[model samples]
Target: MSVDIHFNASALGSIQEVSLVLFKSWSEKKTLPMKLTKQGWKVSLSLPAGEYKYAFIVNGGIRLNDPEANAYAPDDDEKIWSVLLINAKGQRLHSNQSYRVHLHDYSLATRFDGPGLPGVHKQINLAIDESIVSRFEFTQVEGLHTVTLAWYTPDARLLQWSDHYLVENETSAPIELMFRCQPKTLMQSPLLGIWSLKMFIDGAFVLEDDFKVVDEEVYSRRDFLGCGAD
Candidate 1:
């Protein structure tokens, strides 16, 4: 029996075109196109258990591998290909089940198109139960830029704290690292409300953004923050 696989190429966001290629088993060697969905660019395939080499063709020319690839190997032409190991006994949805399946465990990668400058933006986590996401996307000059985040409850209690580092080469346009403050995990329940967020860049306070969580799609906020968040 073969296993159904779902590959996500949403890291590049919505661009010109995103395609997939399979290698290793000569019979399954082919290129497949991905569709842009609400969650992101996704494509499903059926295959038996085996270690296959694959790569993504972006815009019909660029041969890019998955950003979240587990391993990578060089092809005969020295071109690199991402590796994926499929387990025959892996967990899967029922044949009649109408649900989504992630490549591995549920990856928490969110798609954020940073067409604008450096700042935090609000997004919804469609992969989950449509939760809240405070996505932070930005670009900067050389040197190690450390992003420190702290989430506080409405009562001013510390909810979550996280930090990430990014080192860029000496260039004008560098890849901007994407980070987010979800305030909770898929396993744990979320506390819906406007949560305060304090961000620090390289040890200094940079900015403060709030995440207004709700169960609906409409965007809104109160005129005044009842808590003293200064």
Candidate 2:
């Protein structure tokens, strides 16, 4: 059966392309090219019913696991790979199903295009439902819960961070939170890389997701002029 696989790494800028390294038949390794899309990367392939593991290679290097991968297991060397099961259509298998948290809606915006640069404007909008308030340990007080936004480099290093946001429990209704997070200094400009927004409730990690600052799209004027070598 042919199954469609998708991987979005919009947060990782400067990436020209991504390829899928599929581990099939218990030991066979197959590499397939994935197409780039405005949203991210995707590929479709038909394979015999069985289990498989795969990893994404950025450009020609940098192996990474699919952030939205259904399942994952570590190898003897401690390398992690995404897992897949081709049993039925529309059926999914996840290892972290119980701990999965959902946001009502979320969106990210940035001013710089193509790849991230220093001091680029960035923002995030998050909506939460009253039903999930207990997940953040609503203490009936607005000042108890805290929200943290951290930016990391491509190699996964802390680059920039914002102060904690205190949650306000004024009503038991749904609420939306907006954060304007862009660095103001050259040191902060080093924030040009893939990072994750982490939500904390009383020092506990409640929500987290990764994002990229650059992609394969050519945005420079020189590239438009056919004068720049990409």
Please give, for residues 102-202, the per-residue lDDT of candidate 1 as tens digits.
Answer: 11111122333445442333433433434333445444434334455556655555566655554555654544444455545532756566656665544
lDDT of 2 by residue, 1-230 (tens): 77778776544446777899998644688999999776668898877777788877766754556545665565566455667877655444555552222344444554223332223223221221111111122233332223444455556654544323334445764444545444334243334455566553322345566665542233677667896656
True-structure Cα RMSD, model 1: 17.5
Give the number of colliding residue pairs in candidate 2.
Answer: 8
Using alpha carbons, what is the TM-score of model 1? 0.36
What TM-score, computed on C-alpha atoms, does each candidate reach? 0.36, 0.42
